[model samples]
Target chain A: MRWKHSDYTGWGRVHRASGELARPERAAALSELTKDETAPAIGMRRSYGDACLNDNGRAIDMSRLDRVLEFDPDSGVIHVEAGAQIGHLLKTFAPKSWLPPVLPGTGFATVGGCIAMDVHGKNHHGAGSFGQHVTEITLVTPKGEQIVTPKKHPELFKATIGGLGQTGPILSARFPLLKAKGDVMVVTERRVADWESFIGLLDTSEATYSVGWIDATARGAALGRGILEEAETGGGLVKPAKRGKKIPLNAPGFALAPPVVRAFNATYWRRVPDRGRTSVKPIDDFFFPLDKIHDWNKLYGKNGFHQFQCVVPLSSVDALRAILEKIANSGLASPLAVLKRMGPGRGGYMSFPMEGYTLAVDFPNKARAEQVIRELENMTVAADGRVYLAKDALASAANIRAMYPEHDKWLSAVTKADPDRAYETDLTRRLKLRDPA
Target chain B: MTPTWIILGATSTIARAFARLVAERGENLLLAGRDMAELNRTAADCINHGAPSAEAIAFDARDMASFAPILDKATATEGAINVAVFVGSMPTQDEIDGDPALIAGTITDSFTGPAQFLTLLAPLMEDRGKGAVVGVGSVAGDRGRLGNYVYGASKAGFHTYLSGLRNRLGRSGVHVVTVKPGTVDTAMTWGMDGLPFLAQPDKIASDIMRAVDKKKNVIYTPFIWWPVMTVIKSIPEAIFKKLKI
Candidate 1:
């Protein structure tokens, strides 16, 4: 394997890493590369932080190794390479009435990334996290390749999930796919007046997939006002998606400034009538709404942005409201803010999901915004909640350990799997996740 | 009838992408390469994508024995049998300068070996009177200069061989496309500096598919390379030899 000197950044582009990267195009190559080299494996770099980074070190780029190895149409179980993107699976199988059981906000997230993050989807209330559906995984460590299943090696399975690629490099995985009604989605968009109504709507939503888009710029009476979009798989013929659009270049800093964001949010909120509206869309349009515009992160400008996502218990909804209120007052939030209800479903020791409400908001990387995110992290911990590691670019090490009580277990498992600290990434080191509690 | 594609040097990134494209179109694939493990993975990937049948066969440009299995695999399938040649070797100019013996291996891997194999397979394609052969040559072959003239000469030989094959095959209703690609982002040019018009492997793969569909005899990928190479070729030998590009 040839190592290329590459400077890479995560999706948010907030943090950067310069390293030597070896991109293996096949599983055999990956196995051979891992046998001697000690490096973390990264997929797509969809995580908004350094979880995918290794500064001044060696790392493996797993994107080229993406491939679907096997699929059972009847059983709806597919075995895919770790680098395979979930979007590819949806595009291939949605027409066949099967889809990944869980999908993150972006279709570009690789299967390996989804596993490493143990990502949840809009249907977290129904399907749990991505790893819950994974039947088995082939993890390639410096020692050798080990195939672990949920039943065969539950502890290692749990550790590898949301383990941030520390357990080992994931080679391939077998996971059950969900049965879709059709290739299109019947989506209902309703306007929520405030935080109460948004939470009420989410709490009462019966749809298989539900998510709320919050107008983080709104304050006082209008605080938390946004649209609740609920969707269900429906059958019908629609024109296939047009060629995806590109963002072209990074916008100026003023593009997502307070006034522009407020105006955009107001117009976006009124897109649906007070009486509510329903429409049919291709599955991708509803699931990965931002994906139509490729590299939308460039909208945040060159410095990049930070996404602060946290989940608080159901009883702590009021604390969550206070956090949103703080964000509203700051006037630093961007147009992309989301709120969702999660069931008590998780697959890993360090998994982020809980039986609570999860709020995700983006802010342009600036001093005030960084301060607000730190304060928000404090409030989240006070509410006995945890933040999503995939979207966090800023969080103190102590705060992270306090948030994830099972961190020690995950740490022990990772240490055992990679005793030489072969797979430590920027996030793990920053959070002191590899060190004993 | 389903079209069957035989891919040479299937372990390369561009060849893998090309095989996947043909696989997605519901064609059959026979991946020929030196590494069986890598080839098998790609074959499985193609099969899973949509290929009616996908199999991996051993192939080594330096070994004559490896060529017959590929030919047999192509003949085993019915209907139009398309073949794409993505075989070549590029040892750095400095390495070649140090070891003169490297020249023969380079010629065999890039020009003579594939030319010989295709010469044997040409009769079968003629008898069938259908199919296409995509011979991937490089824009470096346009003119031998300071950087990598040894590899350039080998590709130049392959280009001439492809032109003659195209002339011969056109009479039998078989198409031959000689694809001259600029610096593509592959293992070969992974960390190379000063690469102009660097193209992705998938983009090159799609370009080859489009060229084959259009039955174009000779084309340059990214399209810009045609003009760029034209200008480079037009430079006078007196000055071109002095300036290192």
Candidate 2:
């Protein structure tokens, strides 16, 4: 394929970037692609922002680099191709009690890219992020190929985990797999008519999985009414896994706006609560309800859509409420707004977590939508929580570093390993993120 | 088997350029065609050019059923076809002068065969979720001109199929690209009467590869054609029916 350094994945509202599109089949190919280039690597083209973009450089399409090399069912660890999709692994190995340690919603994403992006999920509040589960990564460093784990290269490991592909082109990874109890979960649905109910639910059960919210203005007189779904992987086989094999089909374009989503969310919430507090959901329903539609992202339409996800400290839940009220007051067609909780930030220098609240809102990113987001980001900073790098469409680099606090140490490790700055990506270039040294 | 790309149409100037482009980057190159010697020579040339791995797998994209076994065997030897580029095709306009039966057969070979192979082969890429299928089309398909309209129609149909596949396979992480070259200088266009501008196969291949990387749905090789074809395709038949474009 043509090696282009391009980045148009996120923000048609923003400037689209570019990258190198080199295909690497094996180790030698991987090394060659990673050869002292000023570009970084790109996978599955899912990043909503410039993370996958490296200006005037290159991006090795690691999707083809996938190869499930080995598996230890007992140990629940897998040696796989850097470009392998998590969904594929779940189908083939998850049944046998093996899965990628970290899985993002874009199941088609490459494992290596996931680690590079350090994706997190609903369970992120509990498990931190995908990188947290990564035991080791095979790096095609400019120096040479080295199998680096935490112990092998502690500094580089941390940096690479959240370094956003600046450290090196991740060739493959050896990750610990979890024994999946089918793609099923025990979910409890509760309607939060206002901010109080929302916080009340959060204070109660510390579920392994959680997420939900509604733009009450979109829901008519039900200001701030929303459903909060909490799911837990309770031990024990529930039912035989349907193990659906049908590939996701394309869906018709249906806009989920404040009005439409509020109606749907209201209906959905009513059904859930009526059915009782406890219910069973397919893993897809619980984890990635949107994954079923192949190009569901396009539903946002030609202008494209952007999700602004940020974590706000517990003390700042009031700030989040103020922000929601502000968004509601604006009277824009916001169909989707999510609220979740974050725990401790283990070590990701740019980690977006705190013992606080996280809110992710999906907006059709038209022109000037960024300005609105920046206003919210200002509020987040004021609240002492930060925007998630993974889902952020726009967050100033200074803001990111300021929020994470470990920015300096993170860059030190990156600069040390990638001395030539040969691994800059769109995300790095956009925020002007660089080695502090 | 660690995964290798076995290009079936290695002799076409377009195919050769793609091989050279990929080989230049240090990947394993395996060329296959009717001309075994040319295939081998190209394989050696690819290796010399710096491909990390290179080999020749003799097969044809025209013969549909035979391809599965050959592809299965080759991927068995090398891993799987991460990106398969179909650059082999019969000359355009030949269908105009040729018999209807012959035209249908050629069209099947050119269109249905590749489509079948793609549908069959898609499962593997889906299993992998990272495979991409790049098919070469022509801007002639933008509108049915007097010169190469039949061929253009087939390309258009093929592109439509590609759109469906792209949509169907996106979640599986596989991508399909439709490369519509505005005009290209390949053996098929050697002595054609009048042509204003024609892109070099290598240059066009370069554009095709980039579109593939970007996972773009449809790409105009030179980028200029993006607008040119838009205007051309948008031309009203009522106004244009009076005069040829």
CAPRI class of candidate 2? incorrect
lDDT of 1: 0.92
Segments of candidate 1 deviating more than 4 angstroms: none
Assess each prediction's global lDDT (C-alpha) against the native: 0.92, 0.67
Q: What DockQ would candidate 2 receive versus the native complex?
A: 0.03
Give candidate 2 misplaced runs (Cα > 4 Å). Answer: A1-7, A11-14, A18-20, A36-38, A216-223, A234-262, A275-277, A345-347, A435-437, B1-245
Best by TM-score: 1
lDDT by residue (A260-316, candidate 2, tens digit) is 755666576576554448877655556656556556666666666677777777788
Error of 1 at A237 (Å): 1.8
Model 1: TM-score for chain B: 0.98
Top-scoring candidate (DockQ): 1
Measured against the true two-chain complex, the DockQ scores of the candidates, in the order shown, are 0.66, 0.03
Q: How would you encode candidate 1's per-residue C-alpha lDDT over B199-232 as one tens digit per residue? A: 9999999999999999999999989999888899
